[model samples]
Target: MTQNKAAPQNSVETYTIYATSNKYNRPPPPSTVALHGMDLIGAPIDIRNHRFFHPPPSHLMSTTTDLIDKLKSSLAEALELYPPVAGIVEVNEKGEFYIAMNAENRLGTPFLVEIKDTPYVGDSETLSPRLDMLLPPSSSALAVKLTQFSCGT
Candidate 1:
């Protein structure tokens, strides 16, 4: 696993946000799971899993920070159970790819939080370009982002 770094922010954009990795509290047991032939065949493909939620009500808005903190903590705990999510795919000397995990190298999952001053009105069903902004940059395994809109959605 390699050290995780936040992608550079674009000064031109005004959204307030920050990125960080949510690592397991305790290192997961060491293991290397080799990818099967079928897995390797689809390795080059770009697959994304995204989900969005409605913003909290104005009365509960004050807990936004608490909500984000809870999310990060829960993600870390989940990584402890599913260690492979915290692992990275790497090419071995044989040029074969496998998910590698060890105590020495823990590449945690990327977690991002963004606050948009505008309401979110993008069509969730259509492949709208605007929806792409909700996800973190590409990673070998997993990435998550939470976007909160000011209009409460």
Candidate 2:
């Protein structure tokens, strides 16, 4: 990852990109999947799952490109199996929420790579100040973020 020359040394920086399934893979049928009763139970609540991983050995992943490539590839393959994850959440005419996807125009998942100048400490009880920036828009069905610390953890 290239550093931004204008950014402050201690400020957090992020690179945003999109990842899509392989073009050769069969696309999902163009359809609208309505949210059932169980799905509607938590419709008003927003929840996110955050995961962190320790850096691999230098020999395995020596550069940031390798890490980003692997992640994008993996996510693409996963999308092939679960196409709904790449869909957008939309409201129907009757005020019902559903996932919508088009075979001809696939909406890829949002992928973010955050570079931190400092080493990562354990998760704190308090929410992060940049939490809003780290998450995808509410309309998106899925997203992924990879945070790389200067200390490689």
Candidate 3:
């Protein structure tokens, strides 16, 4: 098995968080600051930084690093080869995963995505599985801040 997989260099992932109905039917936005996975202010930082962590029993930090490399490579062709708004990984939540953003992400509209687990997240992080999405341009970059995920494997 490979030590770590690399992410596409030019690939950009994105996540769509729907706000509660009472809260204007919006999940979380870039402004909604939160800890763990509650923030919806922009894009979930967790999905951006580290989608998942290596399983318990250290010695795979290198694997995570490799994920980054693979992600970069994936991005280079995302705009033309893959879906403009695609998810990167799967997480504890059923629908929680990374979303790839290309030239298709729009503003002032409800953006929904289907997240999936990548080989990288699967090879190194927890068994639960999680995704790391790439985002497109937003009306306000602040409206789509990324925090990178955190986990204990």
Question: Comparing candidate 1 with candidate 3, which one achieves the higher lDDT?
Answer: 1
User: TM-score for model 1?
Assistant: 0.65
Quote model 2's TM-score: 0.71
> What TM-score does structure 3 among the candidates reach?
0.21
Model 2 clash number: 0
lDDT tens per residue, model 3, 1-153: 667755433233453332222323332223222233442347534332334344433354355445444444333333223222232222324644333232233222222222233333343333221344443433222123222333323
Question: Looking at candidate 2, what is the lDDT of residue 130?
Answer: 40
Candidate 1 residue lDDT tens string, 30-105: 6788888888653253345556777567577568777777677777677667777777677788988787776444
Count clashing residue pairs in model 1: 0
For 73-137, candidate 2 gives per-residue lDDT tens digits of 87777776676777777776698877776653355666767676667777652223244533343
Ranking by TM-score: 2, 1, 3
Full-model lDDT, candidate 1: 0.58
Clashing pairs in 2: none
lDDT of 2 at 51: 69
For each candidate, give its TM-score against the true structure: 0.65, 0.71, 0.21
Candidate 1, which segments miss by more than 4 Å at Cα? 1-28, 56-62, 124-140
Q: How many residue pairs clash in each candidate?
A: 0, 0, 55
lDDT of 3: 0.32
On lDDT, the leading prediction is: 2
